[model samples]
Target: MSTSSPMRTVLVANRGEIAVRIIRSCRELGLRTVAVYSDADAGAPHVRMADEAVRIGPAPARSSYLDVDALLGAAKASGADTVHPGYGLLSEDAGFAEAVGAAGLTFVGPSPEVIARMGDKVAARAVADGCGVPLPPGTGTLTAGQAAEAAAGIGFPLVVKASFGGGGRGMRVVGSPAELDEAMAAAGREAGAAFGRSEVHLERYLQRPRHVEVQVLGDGHGTVVHLGDRDCSVQRRHQKLIEEAPAPGLTPELRSALSEAAVTLARTVGYVGAGTVEFLVLPGTSEFFFLEMNTRLQVEHGVTELVTGLDLVALQLRIAAGEPLPFTQDEVRISGHAIQARIAAEDPWADFRPAPGTVSTLELPLGPGIRNDFGLAAGGAVAPEYDSMFGKVLAHGADRDSARRRLVAALGELRVEGVPTTAPYLRTVLSSASFTEARHDTGSLERDWTPDPADRPGAPSGTAETVETPTVSSGTIRRVRIATDRGPVEVAVLGRAPRSGASASPSRRPGRESAAPGASGPGGAGAPPIAPMDATVVAVRVEPGQEIAAGEVVAVLEAMKMEMEIRSEVAGRVAEVLAVPGGPIAAGSPLISLT
Candidate 1:
């Protein structure tokens, strides 16, 4: 094994909460930190917190965060000797890691060869099979025709997953053969857009499995140790929403097996720095299968830190600087329970649609056992160009129940205005009976849970506050906050109530004007189909005169890298299809006119 050179300065080649998180660790280690940002994040908290900041490019991720040349240039100009790809963007890109090494800068991760080998799911499966790690039955990368034939042999209820990349972006679950073609096409498109590679493969879909993962660290000196495990089954749309440490309700034997498997894989790959090996645990059985390994620090690494009392980022920095393992597996210990809830700018009632807006009011919870790692502040903007998640709220306690309750209390104390957030919805999940009993699996949230009616969109809760200010025009506009039996509700009195007798038109929500002259009311027949949020049109599946039934997808929109199907709310004949693929669209802009 080759030793890396000493590192004095590090450049965080990412943005948002992860950047801020890496910067914090660098500060503690007395290492200079440089932050790179796009035009959209000039005033972000990470930029201000870093020792120095650089402007890479425009707001689009392709132009800034994922641009390898831009990141290397920023590292060179900022006098950074090391580059830390924090969990997303080009974090797992083998090309980026190789580029950093070619530029004579240390990449704070495993070698490029390891990244490439493990990044491809098909190849990783072979590696696991060789190591005697359990793996699900799956096929290698396939073309469209080959995939169709393979699906028949593999049978129905299979998963189509991108060969490269993680984060649930290019994944689709098909229950029958009829859905295979469309699912494959959509998955390929998403994979191509997110990662440079679009190749995909098939795997047997597990039913109601628990998403569990083991956190492992290596020092490249033939030393690898597992830092316990995490349960991330509380998910929506296949993305994890809540995570807990020590993976509550795991038997000692199963936990030991998972750790041993993770350590074995890391040793086989000659892994270095922080990484996670994920697995799917079959409910009511001891069967578990390897999912994939993340080559960088995970988003839920903090949960491991809370339970193990180790600063994983600090360890990553030390390992990159050619330090040997300071402690062995026998010395590692786990204590206390920790739960992390992701706070994203999305509306749960609107199918978790991305809701981007300026932060008008920001109040994070503070107390014993509560930690908030936030990226935005009051007056900061949650831009539509990136991931909707801006922060995480974590709670630690003596045990699982205590930790869960503390997290629930912390979420209740949290407040974010100006944009819809997942806080209320997350609070509901944490308090649910399934969660309390540790009976919730990966599919429970989508299949068994629904948001409380009080937390629905436009429904007033006790915590709801006026988020927008009415603009003063020629006519008087009055804003009032009334205390209601449910909660406090805000109302805008437009134009002095129409002078007590003159015919008045129904007031519309601020900034939401009718898209067309003859458009019907919201969700009614003959209404023009409007964009639910700011996004890019990925495809238009409808044309003029095409008949569409309610709940039928008319188009697909890409926002924050997540694809959302734009479904018609009422049955109607399309009068005109206004959406063009690859075009930018704003919330409430008409996409299709229906008659």
Candidate 2:
């Protein structure tokens, strides 16, 4: 049975574009809105846009957005009657949702029991099986010993996944038995950090699967409808960078099956509110398996909204308010096409490293059938404590080709400065033949994509100029005064000592050079796997005297909300471990010396 209650105010328990998006919807509904922020976002735009705001905790997510007590306190203090967890952060956290309800505030999502049931990979798979939804060949949750035994039956080239993780965390593909232990270890660490769980399971790994998901909406009145399918095959390191609705080139039968399957699963779970049902499809085939269900609004939901001409957030609010189905399945109409590009604060050409800083300039694309969801304004600082995604640009048109053209043109008109972004890279992908022809798969990025070396930060061209610096002995800043037409100006200059021997540059800065060709033996003295970018060492997997094979992960570095594994380029013995977990590292700094 569903309960009906009116909500006067809503607290958006999230930070970033999603929060801004929710506030707009609440404003349209004539509802007051509250915003929560951490110390790092005290002055953020979301905080200023809401009817009321409160500081939850510190910069780290653990102390702020993920802190259930802090969020509950804010809601109570602000007298918010409802809570909207706008994707990521705590949106999918079942416990947090339960806490919000216990505090007498409605969570704009499914019940906590439903969330827990679908959020756990193991349980979700069982639910899918009972619902007759196809699933990938896999095992239930497993221990370390159980995983080994399961791997033997699953054979090589299997994926180990955290039973209670999402967004690609706690997942690893093991090609052989030798790599199983290391993969499990890395997956465990990432799983623990991402979801606070270390338990994992095994599954058969598909080499070239296309990721397709359906946007599902359900009201407590037993009405569930799918908003159609989205093709999210374009990704980097398992994180989606681009998404589109009505998955290109999908057969009508297949599309119907996908949608029907999603609705079936939602009805089986008695799902309520906004949710996403994801699937993995084998390229060039209609066979697809249930991947997982996200029990909240997705980041790419705007694309579906555009194609379907509906406000998902508004629907979520109505459902949570005990409203019945606004329309029947046959009444739902999906026309045209829509695409969304995730503009992240990172340099695509530089291993997609985080490039957080102040936004010196901002220019948004404006035209018919175009929308840019963002929280950034000129002079706003993009903090490093949160996800690197700063905005999303979406476009719609009467047809797929038209939509693609509009999206590409809009991306070209978009401009940003003071930090590198994936804008240019996204444009390239949109124009690539593989994408236009809909031939790309999940592994397309690793196999066929390469960043343009010339793509720089999103800054205006012809305005950048180089300045020469004088050699200095120390790394401290010195004050200097310059005369200007208006008045005298003061500037601070930091100095750096030249690298020894290699005065031109630090190409061979000690302990960084590769081994001489023809060298042989365990102590061959090869160049170590250096830090690809400045990041925090989240995990070190190797130790001195440990033997590792080529392609083995030696350490994991985290930057800009993404993780990169530093792997051995050649088989050798670990000679030294220079970095430890929680340590800061500079680009090109040796992490593990190999011999």
Candidate 3:
């Protein structure tokens, strides 16, 4: 590969906001862009933003985004010379990279061999060790017998993590030997569902470690540089909620060391394109350990872009085109501070359950230093078939405090009716002392954050309603009624019917209604374990005649990328199982009957 040839057209092998973001960059660079979408994204914003759009497959990722052959076919059909895989959904698949190159199209990422080496957690640890990078006490992929044998040395309170896949999927913490089996089993199931691999390994679990990561960029010409660091400490179940650039409160020496380590690891593997090298910083200590390397653009790359004043997507395209580094390490400078809050279609009050439906009205905040990356349009449907995140709000300012203040203000101004979001919760996080003081860790949300009832529908927090004023707005939502006398209306009521070109109402979907004559618990006494929210039953772990304990997991329901276990309400024989795996169920629907 050489920089002599020009990249004529780039096909974004992804969907949603990232795809639109890439297209915007390509457009600015005077390069043509193509978009690929599944059946669910036929009318998506990315499709309309591209020079050309192609429908690859059905709604599921396996059939579309993750289908390497299909993506290559799309590139060929659209005459695209390059493919940009926005984060997640097979972005780090080495096989996909190889196939794209074999099809005579650039993958816009690291080489296939490098991707494989870094994508595998077991192999990545070896790479880090060879490069003299600090690593945690961990083992490679282990069989059940090997895991049991190694558990003795690793000790208790270790984590079983899937060797493939990220986003906290397929990870479980075992506090003692008694919990190892169940943890391993659960991790395997989640890993298999997320990455099609169940292989897991053990690592010493650090208590409340800061999830800091360095952004690294490398050219094929052996130039690897760091773009500062980000603190993604605010999280729930391993999923990042808020991320900020420059990792506030890091000593100069420690920050330099972390950046140097990231660059060292990137250069070691001859990495190309944009990537993230994550580290776990011990609480109240300067010590840090290698966690994992994301071999593609990260979800929070926007915050980095805002702070560094660079177009990462543009840089990735140039790198894949075999261009040399445009600037030296010293030239890469960071200015101001930036923070990003992920807005997902989930109800924080209801255990963060998925809140999928049509967006009848969508109003994003607008102001200086505020950036909103989104995918949903007016009347757009938020389908349950994909990730729950629909958008992100990024704020930038001259300092950390200013950035935090701007982010909080932007969140308050954002309004997306018809489906509940994590907006209110994110606001609370930004205002919390832990976050404001930069003292939060990865476990901050789980330990200190709790959903407020006022954030939910029908629960107005600090508002005094007198007269409601109605006005029709353009786009998806036509009318918005605002309370005149208000001290901040916290809750958002459900929106009305679809405006136009929107999918059928989520309420009309089959099996979305509660089953009549709800089954009773043991001894014909209490109510059965009803579904907490609308979700698809992914698995059933119990049989009709099996005797179950009160807290035993009977079934697992998946919604908004989080798995909710349905436990037996009583200790008795399973009288009946009403839900089937892969079947859709509504809130209040019974999952099992015990007697």
Candidate 4:
């Protein structure tokens, strides 16, 4: 094993909760930490928690967090001997890792070669195949034409996956051959934007498969060990929302097989540091197929920590410092069950739309077996230019049921105002029978889950319903319902009074616009399509005089690194196009006019 100089100061190359988590671990190890932030995150909790901070660039990730030169510059200026990449951004970028090594700064992960090999879905498939590991039917990297040709052989109901990155950014599930082309295009665009590589591959879509992964740690000295398993089947749009350790309902033999396969794969590659070998398992069967390997720490690593009582981050630092494994596979012990719920700034009632705003109130649940890893605080901003997730709530217990109950209670106690959150929806999921029974799979959330009526904005009791009153010459008064522990109460809010004989204009907030008289807006006759949120217009699919049908996509908007297709609700002729590609547009802003 190659030896490196001892590290003292570490620079974190990411933002939000993961950054804060890494800094805390470093502090415990008596190491100084340097935090890098964009303009939007200057006041973020992670910045305050670090020993020192450096502003990298503007709010956009491409200009800041993902900028290699800026990150390395920060490391140099801060005199950090080590760089710890937290989860997303450029965490798994092989080029970034190589650059850090070239700059003589230790990267707290595996080798760049192993990262590049496993980060590519196609190449990892070959390694798995060589290791005699089971794999789903899929094709190698392909162009548009090759993808179409392979789609026919793979049949319908396949997934288009980005070859270079994970976290469900560059992935699309096509139900038929008709959707293959668009799926591939979208997946490629997203993959390119997120991972800096557009290469994609195809895989046969499984029916309600369980998403399971084995966590592996390796020392460059040829020692590798598996840290049990985790079930992340509860997902939406291929993104994991909930994760639990000691994946339930796995037969002993099947569990052994998964561990052996993962350890073998990691050892074969001479892997170092922490990594996860993901798999897709057919429910109620021993059959499993290799998914992709995340060459860095996972977002749900907290659950594994809760069960195994090990700090994966500290281990990564030790491995990077040329330390050997402190324990063998036999010495590792898994105890109890643990569950984690991701708290994101999204509106579950609106299909989990990203809802970024200032946090007016922040209250996290605190109690036994509950841990809250949060990045934002009261008065902090949730920037639209980054990922929506800002915090995670984890609960550990003696059993799965106990853990589930604790998480449910924790979420119930959680509160965040000013921005919509997924806490309520997550609570519902934890309390759902599908989850409690371990019957939910990767597709279950999209297939069977529905937003609780009480949780909707304008639902009946226990909801934040809006009641409009008669308009006066000044303006209109709206009563907003607020649910408290006592009961629901209506609070009258006064709007800005308009000028004499003038009508009120819509508020500039996203998704809160009031359609103007004879002006196009959502659900208005001859109204133009409006942007659903604050985003950059990626494409304007429609032009003036173009006839379109209801539900036809007129534009594509990119926000928080996710693409949203803006569809028209009423069929009409396009009168005007207000959105320009690559331009910023506010929520509720019209994208196109219809006549």
Find the candidate with the highest lDDT and give its number: 4
Stretches off by above 4 angstroms in model 4 are: 1-5, 457-523
lDDT score of residue 234 within candidate 4? 87
Q: Against the true structure, candidate 2 has what lDDT? A: 0.79
Clashes of each: 0, 0, 0, 2
lDDT of each: 0.82, 0.79, 0.79, 0.83
Alpha-carbon deviation at 26 in model 1, angstroms: 0.5
Q: Which pairs, if any, clash in model 4?
A: 520-527, 520-528
TM-score of each: 0.90, 0.85, 0.87, 0.91
Tens digits of per-residue lDDT for model 2, 436-491: 89999988876798875455333223321212234465443322221211112122
> Candidate 1 — which pairs collide?
none
Model 4 RMSD in angstroms: 5.7
Candidate 2, RMSD to the unseen true structure: 8.5
Best by TM-score: 4
CA displacement after TM-score superposition, residue 453 of candidate 2 (Å): 2.1
Q: Per-residue alpha-carbon lDDT of model 4 for 1-595, expressed as tens digits?
A: 2233488999999999999999988988888899999999999988999999999999988999999999999999999999999888888999999999999999999999999999989999999999999998999999998988898999878999999989998999999878889988999989988888999999998888999999999997989999999999989878899999999999999999999999999998989999999999998899999998999999999999999999999888888888898998899999999999999987675577677777878899999999999999988988889888989999999999999999999999997877777898989999999889999889888889977656653343323234344555534543332221112222233342211122222221323312122222333354455665567888889989999987788888888888888777568899888888988876556677677
Q: In model 3, which range of ten residues has the least summed lDDT?
A: 482-491
Residue-level lDDT tens digits of model 1 in 128-148: 999999988889999888888
Per-residue lDDT of 1-595 in model 3, one digit per residue for the tens?
2335679899999898899999999888888999999999999999999999999999877888888888888898889988898887878888888888898888889999988988899999999999888888889898777877788898878999999878788898888888888778878877877777788999999888999999999998888999999999988878898999989888888899899999999998888889999999986778999999999999999999999999999899888888887989999899999999999887675556566777767899999999999987878878777888989999999999999999999999998777777987899889989889988888888778876665544453333321122325422211111111111111121223221122222231221111112223211235455554466787888888988876677778776555677765457888888888887776445677667
